[model samples]
Target chain A: MTPQRPTMNDVARTAGVSLKTVSRVVNGETTVAPDLVAKVRAAVESLDYHPHLGASMLRRNDRRTRTIGVLLDDVSHPFSAALHRAVEDQARARGIHVLTGSLDQDPVREQALATAFAERQTDGLILAPTGGDLGHLEAHTGMPVVFVDRIPAGVTGDSVVSTNVSGAAGAVRHLVAQGHRRIGYLGGRRLLSTARERHRGYLRALGSHPGPAVHDLHDPTAAERAAIAMLRAPDPPTALFTTQSMVTTGAVRALRRLGRERSVALIGFDDFPLADLLDPPVTVVAQDPSRMGRTAATALFERIDGYDGPPREIRIPTTLIPRGSGEL
Target chain B: MTPQRPTMNDVARTAGVSLKTVSRVVNGETTVAPDLVAKVRAAVESLDYHPHLGASMLRRNDRRTRTIGVLLDDVSHPFSAALHRAVEDQARARGIHVLTGSLDQDPVREQALATAFAERQTDGLILAPTGGDLGHLEAHTGMPVVFVDRIPAGVTGDSVVSTNVSGAAGAVRHLVAQGHRRIGYLGGRRLLSTARERHRGYLRALGSHPGPAVHDLHDPTAAERAAIAMLRAPDPPTALFTTQSMVTTGAVRALRRLGRERSVALIGFDDFPLADLLDPPVTVVAQDPSRMGRTAATALFERIDGYDGPPREIRIPTTLIPRGSGEL
Candidate 1:
């Protein structure tokens, strides 16, 4: 039931001009006469003629569609959204367009999306890979791929990630300095590299005392349940180090529900919106997602522009903002 | 430098088979013999052959690209991101991918991006139109266009938006019921229809007792400045009604800075992440962006699937959550 679209020939006939003249005018060539240009424009307006970018790209000398694909964990999440926006900003400045898909931590979806993007002949791809074997991507030879937030497993590529270990360590150390020896750890899925790294840091900073730890608290509800259970235990943690923003939110909710927010100190791994506006303003080790996204995009663009150097492992630093929560 | 990619001919040559046989195997034809398919697969693996979707689409009977373009104000914002994710969820279920762009409220950018998507032959378009005139889009007569979060100004199209006026009125009425006769307004850009609708609602609920108001507080910093000035004035509003999430954040910041957070009553129009964890737990009139996004996508797909119908206007309802702040 698709409507018939007006072709260039139709525009040419309507304008009483040759097909070449219509094409030249539509392409914004300098040689077209002013009257001819006006006639072509009027015809185009009346006929609603839209040029086909795919056809034009097939004839382009450079063979670049000026489009990139971005595959992320979840586009709605604050961290992923920030990264996508940063990439968009850079791509826009360079007159490029972006096609994005959410992988949802599914390796099958990741492979499918990567293949789809490749078939579409995108110039490059930037991805936050799932926690699975990336051996399937080896077949996409010469397709410039840049990983963000996580390093690729079984694949050689440039990656931009946060200093998760140190950031988590710093948070735990800050709580310890507050004389909180019995600390609780709220974290994300164990399979994610970021979560594992942060957990390592927590253990390192906790020294010999391996306080209560919960794994796979991917969502706020799960984390909230875990937090409530831990807080009600006999020897509850004096402080908590939440390894992710969602987990941090769940812990905060649990504390509020228990009316113990002021008594139990907390330091979250990632900084989120309104962190400082809470009752006892949330303390957080904030990762620079914008910087990481910008860096990943820059790396991908470089690869597409013929930078054939060795793969890079770029780690962006994090900052700890101590608000009322950590001090308490 | 772009590397040379292996063509179908190369795969045939390597597999020692006819080009037609290799093509059949690559296209997943059932008539291909198992041995011949294995040979083609081996050759494809060795040569890293990738089928070009552009060339295949030229031969496709239906000529559908199975992709759509989404234009938003800014994808990084929480509301936009949530809406985008909802659209993505629907598109993925139908095996469609999304190409997105940020218009940044610039009419020029909006036109450019729309034209670009049209040139790319996207099956449909979902737009949050800028405040400027949308007459430029009238030329895309047969293109499936669905507006989200705002109605098209001068174009005939399907649209899904929130109940802005009623939601705002509900927030104001909730405050007035709590004996707040002097309520301040923090709003977004005056040019935006949503902001104007909310302002109208506020005025309607106030019933001629026009309290202090601020317009064009598009950002938190600007809203904070306005709120501080309003609060420092001789006649300060006892309560605040912020018409946007960012505006609400600014008002919250202003109250905390003045040490009047517990004393001042605040109700925001849009709910955001961590709103429930704030000191008094932010009271908000939450708009259903996800529902709006899903509805807009469904309508656009219907049009794309050849259901040519008259333009429709769909409004999703809003919810007023009475958290502690609004009851103050």
Candidate 2:
């Protein structure tokens, strides 16, 4: 019932002694009576209670913390938040505690957090790694690490990510099929591998007809400006492909402000709450980030449980749900 | 900079010595040169390094972990997610790590997380406490805890919550002003004080004109069903006031599906992303959860800093944002 491995308290209840006496016996302090110690030891043997961290470390082959570090991009973002929830669900089921940190796409912060979590001897780490030189991480920490949402740039390890490139291409294909020759791409930061892969997919789909591609759009204002500028071009894009939900929101805001909600077709990379309730419901290529998180956590847990297999990269497929905008 | 409290590596860099020498100096091993030890000591002093838990415990007037535990209701929820971000922003500024967990409105889970955090020697705790007997927590854990969003029923502590009753009442008043006498209330689970307070507010506002009031609607599906059923009633409600964002989304979905979006006036309790982009942009009694989070975290930090002031219950006011739904 306590979110801990069988504790000394459980032993005390079985041994008919106080927690203090149980602690004394467990710590091998000599002052306790032999009979009480024997009782406590018998109870401990029966209950399988490792007194504390030190005892557990001494007894088990693995110096298990029963805690995992989860470094996400931003827990405030719905995708990251949902992923956190999913990971937590799995960890709770396993009686593990997850310590979370928001990396905020800062590689230095990512490394710093990973280092701290390692210092605490966490069972493993789940990282939605930020871009830049992350090769140092695997060697520097010497800890089991699993990548989530996006693969780490340098070292190949256990990772679960959405098929970003394919999903983006599929979105473009959907737009193209709807007779849209020119589609604007409003993507996330170029530094992110997600953005890069999605951009590649966009280009792959737009092999012949390359439209205006704007990368490094995170804030709604920047996205709105980029979308508006693209809309106002001499040859405007008839359709817009936003790489993220927030970007989609910005583009939608711009459309509404410009009174072109129904005129320009929009399909976003992520699905958000109330997307269908929009004036002209926004179509989206949705990635299952929660499933990705669960998969990544499971993979990490497998590694922690001594699964010595080659690193696997699991790709979760994205789905395109059309409401009103993508068809037009 | 590393997220760790100044480490041996940091001392080595500051003192311009090898990490080995720094470790030797720190560990008080006899092999370190006097000059090197002096340099390391100077660097440690200048960097304000508290070497480890034991050293910090010995040195400090108040043993601080520089880590805070945040137990949110459900971090995946937009409200809780935003709150987490806000709290993290404040903690990061103070060079403190925020260890987060979603309690899922489970009292047992809350206690377990609190105990785990306490075991880890977290400096303080911020809880969006689940409803139940949490009286033992203050005395049992011996940790400073600040409640956010909902108050702890048994024990008194610093808490920051929205003006739920007033907010809901204000929202109902807005709906009534638009000539809606029969309004439906789609609220959250009754176990939550936030939900109960909001329901109380709804009743307060409808003191004279009692309408269809449905409580304990947690998910969007329930909200949608309640809305649909209420709409189908012989004396159906003309307006809907959903207490939460998710509930509002469900009601909106149902209304949209029923093609009664324009017909039924709606005002949601919490504001969410893309609310303004909806066909008839959802009117909401907006609670500033981020600000509430920041306030709760600040209050917690104050307590952590040895502020023995009486527990403060800070109530953040809510705003009624009227777009078109409420106006209708």
Candidate 3:
């Protein structure tokens, strides 16, 4: 038996109209009469003829596909993933879809992903740019773009980021109050805005402290390697402040490897999974990725809705959770 | 002076072609001659006329928007996020965009998200289904769909999952070897395939060994709550086997709260961040989410490329890493 297919003709017949009228209704052409359009739509629904989405979009003004693009540094990271989920949730409520990509912390990949999203004509873009170059966003004016998490050094657009500097300073103050003088900084790539701002806060907190600042640790791409390096150091800082989740993992791992897990105090910038489970639980400056994501999506939707307000920068606050690791 | 908006006419004029020919080229209609099409393309590139993607797609025969949809239980979970990134990476390489959504572990939400994606006419779909019902996938015919992580109870389709049963059995054997006769199984929602399989493995490993199996521990919906319930039990099992990361966190927290941090043995299913940093570093059955993601993506792309040999189920393996927590 041949399968039956529903077509525009069937819808038109059911609505007692010409096929062109059905086509107009399906494409959402505004020229149709209101009463006739409603009848056509009801017939279309009754026949279960889902208008070809691409065709329907074509006949509409503004030509939006009702989709947005989200690009992150690493989707596997807890913060990035949380933010991604938040954005998706908000987009769903607005009857929009989100296209996601991960740069794996590579700039070339980031550019490629952004271009692909734009070429597909995504209505807007949300990116956590890996600091390399962002000339592409400037060149492409077809879509609205927002930067999330880390802001690009050269390019500026709508951005939503955590208060990294203040959060780091707060963490340092908390450590200092606990009488930690020889505090060492564990950081990620300096190119990232969060890392730079966090490092600045570390320096600001240690400004006149009469201790030798061990700026020996530089960028360790992976957490495992960073942890090993810190543990092998001859005179590791008594108190360690890690700038990111990967760095936090590294610092904790290094302390454990050196059999000094309980001796050194540690506070990480990003809260990670099982932080409190560690022998001496970890203290961290926690940023709400979900809130950041919601704000970014809301901003993009507002732009799509023709809100011509000036591009705004939003900073979400961070909290300090004291677990056992920071008390050592 | 106001900037003159470039139009299709200008592009055709520059390329020395008629408006009809330019329209044909822009819409990817096959009637345009090859040589003229090349000239029109060059002119369009120089003019940077990104043909209204929606309109052009509407005119195309295949009706392919070159977009795929990915639905997961929770995108923020480390494993789910890793899988999402992998799928995105693979799709980007093929010049396809990914529309993503999260079900928040709700079956009703999953069904709604699936419908939303289908309404957009996504070329294919990747789903990590929330348990309950999945009649939607069957209803939406001709769309390629792949199930990841947890498979729906009754629905059958292409699936990629970790070797939960074998991995759990391995963990139990390891615990048995370590001289723990009374092993406790902490699991997530029993409806999940991973949870059920892992629990079965625990029972299989403890064949004929009599002990209390506290299957009453609810799903790790709230890790803190689950942790408290497990710890407060009058006679807690000597070794605790947590089947998911959230459960792992809860169990670890419970141990710490009860001041038995170093007294109880704990082995978790999913490897989490800073597991080794805990006082008695957690032992775990570690599954490589990235590898699983890569494999799943490759399988999906193969299916998308029209390799219809048969619907296949691929299983990735997991490994057990012994740490102080399990040794306890």
Candidate 4:
């Protein structure tokens, strides 16, 4: 038969110390005396006590796992990657570990990942929801959750996001200042809060500046297809604002295919790799994903530390970078 | 007292089935009869037999954990992130989950992360070692390990990396062809295997063609600091070769500060966001991080599946894209 696993009580008894001492040592609290620490360590080693991290965390009076789950649409995305690193850095200083999952922008996958993390009893969750109803999360888990980037409808949580509306409006304003009216909006899924807000910003910005024809082709599922169709229209817009990095790439590809790359001005939201290297360097409204990540992680950690004030929303600013494409 | 957790035997008994049938249902193996599967499901729910994932894994004859630990220097780096996502995608399809930790390029942290993951009994480890000694890893665990990016010295394991030497040489050749005789090299930590390889390539490419004044300022702790020092150098080279993306940013900042932004030529290894948007679009050798990640993950999964064959080193090719900077 396999050996029975030693518990915290065993370690405390072996060390001739109180249960609280063993808890303090296990938790890495520095208040314990050095001699007592050595005794506990010796006893732990002798007992061969391998603490069940999850169980110990759940039973602890403090109720901190010192672990957080980060669910992203795709971990490999440049934006997501930057944010993840920043969050990890911040979490590490507080002695926390990160459990990450890629949802692949699927609602079912998102739900599964969230449920798995919750089952593992992660202290908190930082998620980039796949724009689907996450009602089950609110109903099932009482864990503190902070939404990042795209926010799902009917789900209430603390959120850290870029100023999508203002950023999109700024891009349109820049295009208008360059004497271009008749602008087209290339976006991802309309269901995405970010995409919808950007589209709204485009309309509002266009209304402020007269003579711009605003067309919203909010089909992120097939951005390239939508971009090609928009460009092939009888009268194409002179300027285009592509929301999301993938949409930017598709719009650029469509422009290259039509051989009108330089004829139309373009500005993309969320910068991507090789954007600036294209024929006319692509301009973009760059969101600091790392900053956004740091903010979200900070908020989650604060909540974990007994800050039960209220749900807060933090928006990191985006910068409009002008290149040949945006300048036309 | 806490409720006693139910075991597989109890579940089978309650469901009026054999232990093997219960195991089949839990594993999602399709051999079980439909009626029996329903019965097992009902029993599982009724008894709240939350199958200990690790325990169920061990009970199986194969004893596969179906989980891997990914230890990268910084998971937020675009290259690292891309690779991580690919690995997770592949792992998820196989019912495997990835547990990730960032080492922040610290050897001590890397050791701590490795210990933590091993304690959790991860089936395999995918590491980007901090160029620190990996003797502890070899000594402690018998789990399958795959090294990504920088391979540590004296440690032999399956590794996946980009062709840094040839890629760097190709970049230098491109600059040399563009009439750049004087070139400066900005690199990261020289101890890193990739950094050393890239430096070697830089020397080999410059050796035959009008020996460029090479300044091997390897391993600038921060990009901004490196950028300032490189730009302020007396008799700075006419062209620059940045070995890493962070180094590339430093070079760009330095060039802009010196007002040589439009005049100097640059070719960086590893592309970054908005590389082209600067006054003159920067050229680079782009490595497909996603492919590297997928390949590494595939190799790890294969190893986990009892492929105890000889260890191998796999190198993915990098491509050079010429833009305004290289052309200059």
Candidate that would win on DockQ: 1
Residue B29 miss distance in model 3 (angstroms): 12
* Each prediction's TM-score versus the true structure: 0.92, 0.86, 0.87, 0.78
lDDT of 2 by residue, A26-138 (tens): 77899999999999999988765544443344345555768899999899999999999999999988988888889888888987787777666677999998876787666
TM-score ranking, best first: 1, 3, 2, 4
Q: Can you write out model 4's per-residue Cα lDDT over A225-328, one digit (the tens) per residue?
A: 77777777887788888888877877777777688888988999988765654668789999999899999999999887768777787889999988779998
In the range B1-328, model 3's lDDT, one tens digit per residue, is 6233346788889999998889888878999889999999999888777555565566667677788888887788877887888887777778787888888778888877776677677877888878878875745545678888876788877888889988998888888888988877777777888888888888888898734554434445465465566556777677788888777877887777777777778889989766766667789999877777667777767776778777788888898999888887
Specify the CAPRI tier of model 4.
Answer: acceptable
TM-score of 4: 0.78
Task: Report lDDT (CA) for all predictions.
Answer: 0.89, 0.85, 0.78, 0.80
Q: What DockQ does each candidate score versus the true complex, computed on alpha carbons?
A: 0.74, 0.40, 0.63, 0.30
lDDT for position A236 in model 2 = 92
What DockQ score does model 4 reach against the true complex? 0.30
Q: In model 3, which runs have C-alpha deviations exceeding 4 angstroms?
A: A1-7, A13-17, A20-48, A208-236, B1-10, B19-42, B208-210, B214-236
**lDDT for residue B65 in candidate 3, whole number 0-100:** 71
Give per-residue CA lDDT, model 1, range B39-134, as digits (tens).
999999998898777766766777778899999999989999999999999999999989998888898999888888878878889999997887
- Give one digit per residue, the lDDT tens place, for model 4 in B1-328: 5244467899999999999899899889999889999999999878766555544443455655566899987787777888898889888888777888887778999888887776665789999988888887854566778999877778898999999999999999899898888887777778789988888898888885533333345343365466566556786578888888877866776676677767888888998655644457679999888888899999998898779789889999999987787788
In model 4 chain A, the worst 10-residue window by lDDT is: A210-219
* Candidate 2 docking quality: incorrect, acceptable, medium or high: acceptable
- Highest-scoring model, lDDT: 1
Q: State in Å the error of residue B33, model 3.
A: 11
Model 3, residue A25: C-alpha shift (Å): 7.9
